[model samples]
Target: MKINSTVLLTLILLILMLGAGSLSAFLGFTLGSSALKGVSTPDGRPTTKFASNKATNAQQAGLTLLKEEEILKIVKARIEGKTKAAKSEKLDEDDEETKSSKQKPEEKPQEVVEEKLQPGFPVTAENQGVTLSVQSVRYSGGDLLLKVKMQNKGADSVRFLYSFLDVTDDKGRTLSASTEGLPAELPTNGPAFSGTVSIPTALLDDVNKISLSLTDYPAQKLKLDVSNIPVARVAGLL
Candidate 1:
């Protein structure tokens, strides 16, 4: 009654396979029952204790959980607060600027009033057979113009240079003037020479009266002086 060697080896292998299968099946059942117990309530009912991994993680980390809507509301409130603060700062700056502008005074330009020669002209002065007359006085192109006539009634020829003419204001300040249409030389008993003496209105700003003096050139034997010529400047003209 001796068994074959092949049959003995096959029987041993079959026993080992059955034992491994049983052991694996028991281990799987035990692990499954432990997992079910972990997720079950005390009343033997199934529970969702392992659900919502995010909430579980939050709890573990000791962090407060907030809904999306609540987060958005907080962010919006912060933004609105910042905007209001910026607006308030800008308004304060604008108010300060307005107050500064109101406290300063406005500047005005200096006004230059025009002047005119008054009436009672045609003044006359004579010395040593020489006569100087102011025939008229008027305004031309912002200048005070005086029409003058000169006569040499002497025995010798007299030379005249208007560059030597002296003109002064009431304050004894010298005035600048220009002359035109006058002869350089006057013969004895010659025809009366007429000319114009122009004075700038700018020099007459504070002048109320003027004086004029003239003398012959090279000889200077004759001296003519005209005084008390009036200058009038009224307001309201540009």
Candidate 2:
């Protein structure tokens, strides 16, 4: 009985060990399959969370690339616009210059007429209590300058307006004259007063002789006249 019981116990222990090993192998295979299912989709694709994250990342990258392209395009457009504007401005300036050049005409300088002066001077005239004398002559700045002196010889005072002095060329044309360094009134028995008379040489271009006449203003009582003053041509001067 003891031997039979020992054999039966050994067989029982061997069956239990086989069954436990089979169950352990099956559990390991099932757990491994479950772990694979957790990491991957049923069609062998990645998990939904991982795929969604990857797709979002790709979309963001594409958006970034598009934004970069858009920014580059905007910058290029602005640069090209500025370049075109500058070119347009330059063309407008060139057009304006061309129009201005075509519109205006050139001007010529006026001709200056010159004359010659002779040597006859120191002409004198007397009227009432006044004596008028042309003392000297000179040429300056396209004008003929005459130095003159006046004396009040009588007892009474004498008043004169040099503006009323009349000058005429040989051709009977009146000439303009300006005077300086002369007094409006000459006292009684006063010393001689010196002055200058300037006449534009342009008016004397064809004249050879001139006449001068003077009289007291308002009264017109005193009269002095000198005529036939010759001005001959001089060589080496115009």
Candidate 3:
């Protein structure tokens, strides 16, 4: 069927109007989208300056944390240094104490001396029989104790009838003495006979000399020196 021109024109116009409406709707949607994108949040307006301010705030916070960390490190270093200095000071103090202790006075050692004695009296019709010797003298209990060893040098045995031991102080005071009752006898050509004689404590302080003599024995003359004995620090009676 052949279409009328008016109807065709009317159809064309309606189509054009629809197209224009579509175009206007699409442009409106595009403009609305662009405007919405350009708008800020409901709280306030938006700008590059605001974004820059947020970034600056973030950077400043980070810088503040860094500065705080640096300050903390410095404080920690200072505390460690103080602890080390304290320890060093303590060590120096101990060293000084040790040095001072080493400078104190020291004690001296005690000395000991020995003496020997020989008989000087006649023993037989021709010659002397034996000799008496004092080997050592020691001071103990505020007194001096003499150790005497006698030897019989004669060919025959000799018996000591009576003997005596004596010790004198620096003032000629008799410190110690043994009578004949305490005589010690020895056999001929045998080992020496040993005996101990003790002096009184009262005379020990002034004792500077010692004498050992035999009155009735075959060998009578005998003597010894014992002046280097250490003085007793404590009283003998106590």
Candidate 4:
């Protein structure tokens, strides 16, 4: 059968339309699978895989930077705290030392001793019709010369034979004895007999208790009682 030109054109158009629709449906299925495969991620991100990865890397870098900053801040704080503590400790030590230096030392007290005098009823003696009273007794010495002054207050002349000075301590213990030939005799009218006694410095630590006793020649039995003599001490004597 012969077809008109208008009908032929219509038929061709319909065929072309149908073929295009079928081709479109096939292409949509094939491309949809490829697009779905390309868009899917294991972690569930959809359209922006490359951008998401870049964002994740950036976030990790930012976290690392923040951790580093935190650590540095902690270290700085620790250093500053240690420095302040050391400064405070040094100040406290210095203050304690200053207080100790300003403190004063303690002082010792002084001691006082009173002097005692002898009792009354002085000792008396008579020999060869003459009586001699022993008066004040005194001591004098500097270097090697130690002398005792004995005043005779009696009216008659008496011979002081073998007179010796006995030096003793406070406890009545004899420390030293004077050598012989101290003073031969005492003239009645002359100033009371003065005798030079030799005593080493080691023997006389305390010279306050030294006694001077006299013995007469004719009798040689009676001892002159002349204790409690006022003894003096001289320094730098060897």
Using all chains and alpha carbons, the TM-scores for the candidates as numbered come to 0.47, 0.47, 0.34, 0.31
Residue 98, model 3: lDDT of 97
Cα RMSD for candidates in order: 21.5, 25.9, 23.1, 26.4
Clashing pairs in 4: none
lDDT of 1: 0.84
Residue-wise lDDT of candidate 2 within 1-238, one digit each (tens)? 9999999999999999999999999999999998887485355556877898899998888863458889999999999999999999999999999999999898789889753333565678887778887766666898887778898897778788988999998999999999999889888899999998888998888987777888876688888887776543455322
* Candidate 1 C-alpha lDDT tens digits along 1-238: 2568888998999999999999999999999998888485454333545455667887889966899999999999999999999999999999999999999999889789853533575788987777888876766698998888888898887888899999999999999999999889888899999999999999988888888998889788788899987666544211
Once superposed on the true structure, which residue ranges of model 1 sit more than 4 Å away at CA? 1-119, 234-238
Q: What is the lDDT of every predicted structure here?
A: 0.84, 0.82, 0.59, 0.56
lDDT of 4 by residue, 1-238 (tens): 3568889999999999999999999999999998888575566555568888889998888863448889999999999999999999999999999888788565667667643322321233444333333332323352223344444445554555443434555568775555433345555555644445555556555565445455666755535544554444534221
The pairs that clash in candidate 1 are none
Comparison by TM-score, 1 against 4, better one: 1
TM-score, structure 1 vs. true = 0.47
- Backbone Cα, N, C clashes tallied per candidate: 0, 0, 1, 0
lDDT of 3 at 173: 59
* Backbone steric clashes in candidate 1, count: 0
Expressed as tens digits, the lDDT of each residue in 15-56 for candidate 3 is 999999999999999999988996776656578779979999
Q: Which residue segments of model 2 deviate by more than 4 Å? A: 1-119, 233-238
Q: Point out the worst 10-residue segment of candidate 3 by lDDT.
A: 118-127
Best by lDDT: 1
